[model samples]
Target: MSELPAGLVEFLESAGWGGAAIDPIPGDASFRRYFRVRHGARQAMLMHAPPPHEDPAPFLLVAQWLTNNGMRAPEIYAQNPREGWVLTEDFGNDRMRDWLDDNPDAEVSAYAGAIDALVALHRLDPGPFSPYDLAAYQREAALLTEWYCPAVGLSVDEEGYRAAWDEVLSPMLARQQPGVTVLRDYHAENIMLLGDPREGAPQGLIDFQDALVGHAAYDLVSLLQDARRDVAPELERAMLDRYIAACAPGPEFEADYARLGAQRNAKIVGIFTRLYKRDGKPRYLELIPRVWALMERDLAHPALAPVARWFDANIPDELRASGGGTIA
Candidate 1:
């Protein structure tokens, strides 16, 4: 078991919730760590984000944004900004992936709710209340290069990658789909199954510290072109259609979707590579082929042919091959 940081026990006690049994939760790629504490009938989750590497402000801000917008994210019970620790309502471990594994038919319905949540976020007025802005979008997109490229022992052709990114993004940005408070990681794993029968509102949402202001299609690609799970083609198409119809993106919808999918998948390929080589998480490697397949399909679209040709000529076969197996 990972060691709990010193003073965590004391911190919990000071929060007025003593006598609670604490269990360490697994760590993710970020500097943040999670813990579960049980105190009689009441339970809460504790987040330990060490200084410099992690900050609790974005989580707090976005949690407020999502909750205010009618989503069922964790409610912050108590917090200590000095230590970067937060106590929040427990959302449970039954994520949407596990729930769908048992009841396959519920996949469409559950995912529909997720898409609905996305639509709600998109439709909400971004007045003084919304915190999303342009800088955050660029930062999140840059992570694809920062985290993923070096892990494969491959350097991105900086000039080529930028040119390709611009070629694909320019037109979509021109039409500028109005920005929203995008929950950058709106995939199945982040969503939770709430009640025992598991048929009501979703209970949890995690890994949202990187929220951004960007295109409507960005989060959709993150959901449909998932690295951790295989979203069915029919379901993916249905969700795409649902978003298009719900948002009424015009003639450029298909083109924007195709272009954004390629951009997002390329970033993901780099990310998955980094996860295996740098982060010591080889399990993500298995998802590379699926991500590549998404890229291939997106590239096949007439709108993205130029970017497709560039990838085929520039990205080495050996590097792509390495994505399927252990990084070495």
Candidate 2:
């Protein structure tokens, strides 16, 4: 662990949370770190974010937004912006993944609530919000070539890849949909199931610091085509249908969903490749085949036929074969 920031201990003491046993919590891809500070029967989460690589403003803003909108994000109890330490409400360890692992029946039912939450977000008119524009999308999509090519020590046909990407995204962008307050990573691992299995509301949502004004389908795809946990096909179909029904009645929903799924799967392939090569996190590699399979399936839909053809024509045989034998 790095040096404890100045005034953190003093601040905790001032807040009456001092002398609490602090244990570091594991972090995901972000630069921010967390520690669980236990104080008798109560507990609080202590966030440690070092300079430059971490920023708390977005987290604070989004928390305020979600809370005001009736979602159950952790409330900020104490904060020191200079030291980048924040003491927040502890939502506990009952993550959706853990709960579903313990009680399989809860998996399908619990997702209904999450899907409802997403519908609420998508329905909101995103006035004055920043868009997750083309530049950001392209930068994220480039990660596959950036990391995987270098890691494998194979030179990528840059022009060919770019052409393929443009070929797919161009038409899709032509029919670009409206924006919403996209949670960006609304998957099982980031959600917590609060209270008892038989009763109580699900109360925790974390790792939403990267929220953006993006397509409604982005979060839906993140939830259904999860990279961390496997949501069954029957459940995924049901959830997708549930979301479509919740949206304003429209003829374009199915077509948009297919296009978004292909686009999202493309982005994930790039992201997972980047994680493996740049971050040395090889666990994501295991999910690539599954994601690719989904992408292929989505592409087969008439809406994404161009993308399917581009992939078949451009992506090298070696790269396709690297999909761990799970790509059918």
Candidate 3:
């Protein structure tokens, strides 16, 4: 168990849950830490997101934004910004990842609910979040060279990588004129099945502190080409068709989807490598090959020809499959 940070009890007490049994939740790749707090029959989640490294404000801002816009971000019960502690409504252990594993029958409806949530979120004007602009996209893509390349004992064509991204992403960026609210990390693990018994499986959103105003297809890519788990190709196809049918987007949406999918997966590959090499966390390394596979799938699209060529020239086929495992 992690030790309690100072003044945590007073913070909880002020929030009317003093003397609560605070049990730590496992940490994710970020610096934030979460805990389940229970005081008699009442319960809530305690978020210990120490600042200077992890700010609770973005989480608070995005949560409030989502709730106000008729979405399902966890309700914030109390907060201490100075110390970076927040008490929020707990969604329990019903993550869509585990929910699908136990209830395979509900996979279609559950994913439908998730896709519906994205559809609804994208329709509204984004809240006061920053734009996921071209610069941001390039910076994220550079993670592959910055972190992953060095760790794998390979030196990639850094300039070529940037040029390739610019060639592919410029057109995609143009197609997403005036962005929408994109939950940057909208995958099964971060989504919870709320079991509302409605036609769509209402989900509870978490880990959306990184939400931004971006392309509609970006979140769809995150959902369908998830690194944590493989979304069935058939289900992925059905969902894409469903989203296209529902939104009636521009003709380039699929191409944009492929482009953003490649970008996001490449970013994850870098991030997971950073976690293992810099942060001393090996678990994320295990997911690298999966992300590489997903990125390759996206790169197959003509929209990603430049990036695909860079990978072919830079990384070998054997490395793409087992680069993460090779780190040790």
Candidate 4:
């Protein structure tokens, strides 16, 4: 086995896990790393962020918040904040994406469960977090110009891009009702299908340290308009209808959904491009076409005229082709 970080190993020994086998788990895009600890009749997941790079407090805080809300975030077993280590209940390997792939017929029921989880999540107080207000939305959407444009060798009217988004999104932001806890990464990979959906049992959630107070439609869009996988159009529509029926979010909810969806896709396209050109992770580029396709659908909404205009003026059809038209 490769040598574990000295600090992490010391933490394990001090925490009475010296003999437990530490097997590294696949990591995500962030700086954090995960390991599965197997000891005699004991199993847990260790999240090692290696401080000065990543912090554990936000994850702990959100975990508490989710647990308090009766959602199924992992239960924290032990923590060493200074070392950036957190040992929590292991949810095992049954990711929602894997489950969906293995049992395609369960798509409806699985998504229905996830939608029910959203209904429950929205019903709770959002706790203390910054609101996903107009400025935040604009700043996030700016990634398209800030990163993706330069990568594609396209010049952007950065000022005009922000202005267009402000014009299109200002009124929508103003009309937004009280925000709910928006799990920023609510797609299939972060969700674990833990139990039967028919029984109304909640599912396990992970990778939600960046939870924020935002529109109810935000997480719904994250799930349906995934950057990694293709959620069938029919399933996406059904799940969306399910959430609307369950939550009955005010009359303007559909517009909010489309707006947030478009905004998120814009941010992701830029991020994926940045990952390839800046971080040397090219595989994410493969997913841009799928993400941009979703963006097109969302931008088609009449409410997104300004954003659509920005795209038209900046990113030509050829520039938007898969792999982002030669990032040379």
Report how far residue 31 has shifted in candidate 1, in Å: 1.9
86-138 in candidate 4: lDDT tens per residue? 99999988888887788887778888888888999999878677788888898
Best of the two (1, 4) by lDDT: 4
Error of 3 at 52 (Å): 1.5
How many residue pairs clash in all the candidates, one count each? 1, 0, 0, 0
Residues 1-328, candidate 3: write the lDDT tens digits.
Answer: 2488877888998999988998988878888888899999988999999978988999999999999999998999999987999999999889999978888888888888888888899889877889899999999999989998888788889999999999999877766668898889999999988773245647899999888888999999999999999788899999999899889897889999999999999999989888888899999877888888788889999999999999999998788666443764
Over 4 Å off in model 1, which ranges?
A: 127-156, 196-200, 317-326
Which candidate has the top score in lDDT?
Answer: 3
- Please provide, for model 2 over 67-103, each residue's C-alpha lDDT reduced to its tens digit, 9 standing for 90 to 100: 8877789999887766677789988988888788888
Clashes of 4: 0
User: Against the true structure, what is each candidate's TM-score?
Assistant: 0.88, 0.87, 0.96, 0.96
Q: How close is candidate 2 to the true structure, as a TM-score?
A: 0.87
Candidate 1 minimal-lDDT segment of 10 residues:
127-136
Q: What is candidate 3's CA lDDT for residue 34?
A: 88
lDDT of 4 at 170: 84
TM-score: model 1 vs. ground truth: 0.88
- lDDT over C-alpha atoms for residue 328 of model 3: 49
C-alpha lDDT (0 to 100) for residue 170 of candidate 2? 59
Judged by TM-score relative to the true structure, which candidate is superior, 2 or 4? 4
| lDDT for position 270 in model 2 | 71
Q: Which residue ranges in model 4 land beyond 4 Å of their true spot?
A: 196-201, 321-323
RMSD of 4: 1.5
